[model samples]
Target: MEEGLENFVPLIKRSRGYEELEKDVIDSGICSGCGACAAFCDRVGLTEDGSVPASECNMTLGAVKCNIDGICYDCCPHVSYSWGGLEDEVFGARREDELLGQYLKAFAVRSKDKEVLKNAQDGGAATSLLLAAVNEGFSDAAVVTGRDDSWSVDSTASKDKKEITGGAGTKYARAPGILKLGENLRKIPRLAIVGTGCQIAGTRRLEKKFLSSVPKAELTLIGLFCYENFPYTRLKEIIEDRLGLKMEDVTKTDITKGKLHVWTKDGKKHEKAVKEFADLAPESCVICRDFTATFSDITCGSIGSDEGWTTVIVRSQRGMDLLNAAKEKGYIEISDKVDLEAVKKTGGFKGKKRAKVLSEREKEGKFVPDYS
Candidate 1:
């Protein structure tokens, strides 16, 4: 029993999802107490304090407490991404070249609620896809987005098998949990993961590796058109300073709203014009070019549809099957040929191409990474 396991017990208990626990443990100091504990857990826990003692121990700490195994960290609710082990071993295989093709896919799932429609950045495609997959038995669980205990407001994987599944709406932040997909691969055999282009790409890299050893049923990918990601620290400051809402006061964030819709603890709603805060997006996003997930099973965006309807690009067989099942079951409303030209007219894919070209050059040693 490491001294830090006690501290990690609280963190593990506090984490709401596997993704939340994985990404946060290292930074939260949960892994600092028992380094071997997390390593024993297979890097699922990043620090020494990340592991808790197992129950049945006769020794008393202070208050009532249960000792957890290092493996328990594997089941921790706080992980964010699946970056360790197999993922790190195959990092060299991930490249723009691998992102060139389309996998199974679907699109254009709109919510019946006008509020849900207006509240979503697209046509509520993300939420619809998860519900549809679960309903159709295509997946055992849907890992969606939600806020962290710290109010970081990142997406967390939802584990509910029924109607009460958790996860807030689409957050503007580029979610950090996408990396946790590989870790949850064992628990939730079939998963429907939602994210933007980069996240989809990163997950696909993981999916490819994981599938090589396991079955493809372990992971499914859904992509949203991402123009940018919000800076966390600055975004928090602005939310508190500009909106006059304390960080903890923020209950949830919505991307579908024409403006940024923020709900506070007091039930007061604050709306920030999306354009006004556009500059707050992360700088790394500017260098990213994948406006649409080139290799994702499905690609979604507002480019080709009305404000309330999502435009889904079904590029693969799996995507078509998922969408077909969703439509047949009446979970989603799909209308085709709504804005084929207009969707194509909304440009920015060039950024993806440019980013890919730069990455290629960097890998080839023609360009060096700029630490600054």
Candidate 2:
């Protein structure tokens, strides 16, 4: 066992199962829909609305009669855990930056590959890094979110460059990308995952639980900056009903500068203020304080860079190594022209929003996840 994990084993052995998860997180309306709970347990699945309890859990059904140590509850990101402990374990130090978390370097980067740039939402830096990791033997496979023809997103494990490229471009909806980790943990020794803040947190929790038996450095986490994400059904409705653009007709969708932009096959751009769709955001997002995926090795976003570049925040030596390898191999170009203030401003905005929401919830005596 990994050092310090022996102390955790007894606590994990006493952990409650899916029944408690449903009562605490799912029923409380704070489920982030990252699907970590259901990923490892076959009896537990996500409902149609993306909540848990799709089927009766084995523990709940008394099939196994095991009331404790359920991996489902233990792996949940929304469940109460020590944020500072996670920070110390992942980064070896607490973050000094109040908003952007710990980081070694930041850059505005773009992919050198023409095809990646053509298909990418912003700078294709994410795609470039994943390709570099696979080609350089940094990882054997990458888990990423991909969209169907109608722009509905799903998680996929891509083992090759061609498969990884299929996951290029951003989808504005939440996907259970961390579920791919649970599915492939035993099969793929070296793995990487690209996901949003909540998904990355769940992946970290999974790593803390299961990766002790394996080499921890074999897993890489690449996170994306996300202020909020919408459900696919509501997003589709807004596109079709509010914008009058059919899902199939829409070629691309992007959120930038506080506006949601949609481009159709006919080359017409339709847009609306992001706040106009505020009602569609899930409650889970309102309580989330992580805007830049602070727990990840690296975080990428389009917030603080030029129109065609991605802002990359390197938070660990692994992240820096992979980024430098990509740059050295001519997979990507890095520029030091990123606007640091812009990035912090956006992160501060998200932090303040989460604070306001938490205060309101506290006043109402609502359940708040123990992020501290």
Candidate 3:
């Protein structure tokens, strides 16, 4: 237990459980299946149809079900969050602009390493940072989202740069990097974790408790910018069946300037207007209000940078420190143009859309949507 946790009583097994989760989260279409529930419980898992639900084995006597007394509930990102509190913990203050979160610097950067740039989604900043952290012993490993054999997203932990780089690039589809993490996280005591908004939120929500559960583990979270995400199989179907492109022929995927582009190893490209695939985006993601992953140590994405460069948002001082150290070590190079307007334009747009959706939901009287 952590220092203050010694005074906290440990949970007994009786609590509101999967039944409540199904009603509030699963049915509500906000369950991202990040698997924090299952990471600690045997009875909960992601179902075949891509939903996270508690298994029948959770039932004990006729009506009683197994539970950890709302442990899973507290870990849920959709149920609760306070970015202000998280920023306070990390940086001792939050940014004045609610949309920008807290940050030390924003820049256009790319890896100086040719190998990383060749494989990364944009500038390779995220990959380069992780590579430096792991190889230089700043981290034991890193949890990352990468492609599985079926082209679906796979969440994994990697110690070596080879394994890390293999998972690079933009996987625009939904992969609960948090959920797919499974048991591998147990082996990583000190490390970095990268994921989308929801995943980062989950990590921050459960950071201390989750770390307490693990023996010596501590985490530095990296959040990827996300407007929305689609189901993996459905996205693959759109590419193969609808667009007449084979999945095997695809090597890269990117969403840029209102277009979806998939490129092959040979540099061939298949393109689709961004709106054409919008309806396939997850219902859970549709109401999401986060654009820059305001709660993470750092947020990186392709939105504000030129081709082959990434715009990095450093939230915590630690994030800036790691980035600077990596740059000094020749991991990456920085661009002179720091484009705040470009970032603000896109981030603000998403924030507005989020507010409109939540405002409508609040008026409908179901409940006020609070994804803080």
RMSD of each: 11.4, 3.7, 3.9
The lDDT per prediction is 0.52, 0.80, 0.71
Task: Give residue 68's error in model 3 in angstroms.
Answer: 3.8
Order candidates by TM-score, high to low: 2, 3, 1
- Model 1 lDDT-worst window of ten: 31-40
Q: Which residue pairs show backbone clashes in model 3?
A: 34-179
Q: Could you tell me the lDDT of residue 355 within candidate 1?
A: 65
TM-score of each: 0.60, 0.92, 0.87
The whole-model C-alpha lDDT of candidate 1 against the native structure comes to 0.52
Q: Which candidate has the top score in lDDT?
A: 2
Per-residue lDDT tens digits for candidate 2, residues 1-372, read 334323223135456677778877888888878887766666777653567764755565223344335777777888888878888888898888756888899999999998889889899999999999888878888887888889888877778677788789988887877655656765665788898888888878877775565553368899898878877888887898888889988888888778899999998999999888878878888777788888888899989999999999999999999999999999999999999789788767666667887788778776777967
lDDT of 1 at 294: 55
lDDT comparing candidate 2 with the true structure: 0.80
